[model samples]
Target: MNVVILSRQQAVERVGYSLGLDGSGLNGELSPALVGQALRRATSILAPCARYELERSVRQTLQPLGSPGDVVGPMVQDVLESLIVYRDLLEMRSTADEVWASAEVTIRPAAPSFVKREDGSIAVLGTAGDVITPIPEDLPARLVHRGALRLLVPTSAEPLAPRLQEFGLVELSEKAWLRLPRVEPAGNYVEEWHRRLREAPIGNRPEGLLICKPTRRGTLYRDRWNPAEVGETGLFVARRPQRFGANLWCLVDLQPNSTARIVDLFSTGDTLRSCDVAWQIQMALDARAGLAQAFRCRPNGDRSTIDFFSPIPSWAERRLFLVGRRQAGTGCLYSYEMATTAADGERRFLRESLWLVEQN
Candidate 1:
């Protein structure tokens, strides 16, 4: 239940941030004192991926869950019961206006359900084994990540599997994603995105170079990035601070339904005209986050979306879940990302999916 996605240009979503997208201090309104200062600044930008989220919650419970302060004392009591279960689902969705009050919807800001979908699918598995299906679907379901998120789901995303058999969650593999095709750019590309945001410039990077740590020296993901390519196997990178020049990026372990994937990229040099002006200033910031064009995939499946509320049916259709790995002759890491979710529809936001280190 480590859900941190609060965009709409009042940003907040970082683990290893720097794929260009910044400005957040919560002033976009929605008080509770800015939702307790945006949940204490998203729990301090997810405390450097807390031991890479406790080693992906200990390989989804493959046993031996002790020490390390006894599994961080129940992962800090399931992150305070996932903030009291999203503050009682935002007080029962603001008094059960229980279905976004009747229609023509347009409220946006829906994640209130202890948002957890590190990869989606796996909707419940109790019987003392616990994984109460996708983080607190309500009713005492304490969780963190176990039950092999059912080997990366994709039985059309239902993944039940759980008949109890001591430390289970074995399914090996099965996760194929698709749906990518959206192109509409060329309308003077907004005057070349205001002349490259008026000629971008700022990030400094070069303080002894090795700023890509996290290899507790074991092997398979010690806390990520010891050379994490292959579309960052379930990513988690955080290095976004220097005037974020060139839209610096790296902050996405986010996946709450409108799924996604596209890891690492900050380009400014590495040839190919710095990767075509860093992918034309990220499609001019994905055309001001409404998205229109950006598709160049090869890694399981390609996808893109803005999905203008597909004739609502309780809304939920905007995807871009990618996964890469094509080393061969090297030179292959151009990226893209865009998000927008709906449970009550009317453009719930999530833009700033990044990747582009200009390595041609």
Candidate 2:
């Protein structure tokens, strides 16, 4: 039997038809313009590397089913081709480019049920009332990455523990996990976090021992460099003791529904803007607080939240914590809960756990 191989274009088109993209429109044929538009959007969202990844995923999924023109070729082609379309949609909706870059996109014919990792990786959590088998290690990098992070696998998949361990991933029963590095403390420093909490007008300070403090404050959105016109404000802080870790806090005014910078940040899918905000805050903090040494900061996790739709008050606050420190071969972990309340009585809570370590 002579096996018929599929060209890359044919494979992509077959996948598109499987995804119902071919005749979903008024015309019986899928528009080339539509495919081009989707491709352009996917490229914008995933960068040029997306094509490489998508092609790889398609080949991997279809290789086991047989040749393109075999008895099961059409069935396999549909499955593989739909994945390509699904990848484009997922990329379009995703907010973080780094997460999408690291993710191995997959789709099952069945319903969706999965556990999401702190770093944004996901694994099947098993379907209700059914024992689910573990996915093969053929796509291990997509499903798991190197790190001492927690996992959320189902009981039925417990048999795959050895393989998961070999891959450097583990499942934890604890509800919270931290992945921060550690660093040596500077030793000489004022207890600014303690004092500020005592003096803050936020009523009675919560009783977990003040471990962090804001080192500086500035406006997140400003026009014409006028401090008086600054409606949005941000704060910066380094994790206590070790001067290596830092955090950023921003309070944006959402008044008159026009001055809301928080809305602007959430709409553009440019969440990296938070990193820029954090860096600016860190620089300001170092200059104002006169720290012994300035520790370099970078984003550690894919955890972030935005709530601007509910009947918000005149302003909203956003915070980013960056920790990179390690000490004596042990990683340092920090946990905190941030609570923000709007003037109109809307409240939101953010729980954070990060590991601190030095940058290599």
Best by TM-score: 1
List where candidate 2 sits over 4 angstroms from the true fold: 1-10, 13-159, 167-360
**Global local distance difference test of model 1:** 0.27
Clash number for each model: 17, 20
Question: Model 2 over residues 199-241: C-alpha lDDT tens digits?
Answer: 4333221112111233222212221122212232233221111
Query: How many clashing residue pairs are found in candidate 1?
Result: 17
Candidate 2, overall lDDT?
A: 0.28
| Displacement of the residue 38 alpha carbon in candidate 1, Å | 19
lDDT of 1 at 59: 32
lDDT of every predicted structure (CA atoms) = 0.27, 0.28
In Å, residue 66's CA in model 2 sits off its true spot by 26
